[model samples]
Target: MDYEFGMLAWSMAGHDKDKLYVIIKTEGEYVYLSDGRLKPVERPKKKKWKHIQVRKTIPEELCSLTEETIKNEEIRKVIRRFSNV
Candidate 1:
């Protein structure tokens, strides 16, 4: 699956398994993710593509946002809504 910016990703493997994160950026075989609080946008967590399940669902709030325009608060809101936390 093509991992796009603003998409939500599910960590399928590794120590962070089952955690939800917003995609901040995508590289060759990796994606940068952030959960707002734990992994802030300023310093996103880098993970391998094979390790995550990209949801490819961009929340309405993040749909219009770019990698640069997105905020931590917005990321947190979307994550909270989806994760039901």
Candidate 2:
């Protein structure tokens, strides 16, 4: 499955198993993920495609953020807020 930017996904393997994360970037079989906490935007987690379970894709406008506008605090807040809903 093709994963879009800002898509929600769950870790299926490794030490961070079962943790929720947002897809920040993707390339080939790897994807850059951030839970906004453990995996902040500046230090995203690199996981394999087959190791994640995609939950759903949030609205593009809501998740779509330019590199210049992407802040760590905002990313944390958004992930926390949406997950709590």
Candidate 3:
């Protein structure tokens, strides 16, 4: 699957398994993810593409964010809205 920015994904390995995260950036075989709380947008967690199960839902607001404009609060809101957490 082609990973893109703003896409939601679930961590499938490690301690973060089943936790929701957003795809902030992608590089080669790795993707930067943020849950908006523990792993905020400012400091995204880098994991392999195979480690995250991509979700079909993409937050339209996030798609317009640039690196400089991405905010942790907004990311959190999006996750909470979708995951109902």
Cα-based lDDT at residue 82, candidate 3: 78
lDDT of each residue in 1-85, candidate 3, tens digit only: 6998889998999988998888899999999999889998888999999999997767787877876688888888888887874
* C-alpha lDDT of candidate 3 relative to the true structure: 0.88
Predictions in order: lDDT: 0.92, 0.78, 0.88
C-alpha lDDT of residue 51 in model 3: 95
Please tell me which predicted candidate would have the highest lDDT against the true structure.
Answer: 1
Q: TM-scores across all candidates?
A: 0.94, 0.80, 0.89
What lDDT score goes with residue 1 in model 3?
Answer: 67
> Any idea what lDDT model 2 has?
0.78
If both were scored by TM-score, which would come out higher, candidate 1 or candidate 3?
1
Error of 2 at 28 (Å): 0.3
CA displacement after TM-score superposition, residue 41 of candidate 2 (Å) = 0.8
Better of 1 and 2 by lDDT: 1
Q: Report lDDT (Cα) of residue 57, candidate 2.
A: 63
Q: Identify the candidate with maximal TM-score.
A: 1
TM-score of model 1 relative to the true fold? 0.94
Which pairs, if any, clash in model 1?
Answer: none
Locate the minimum summed-lDDT window of 10 residues in model 1.
54-63
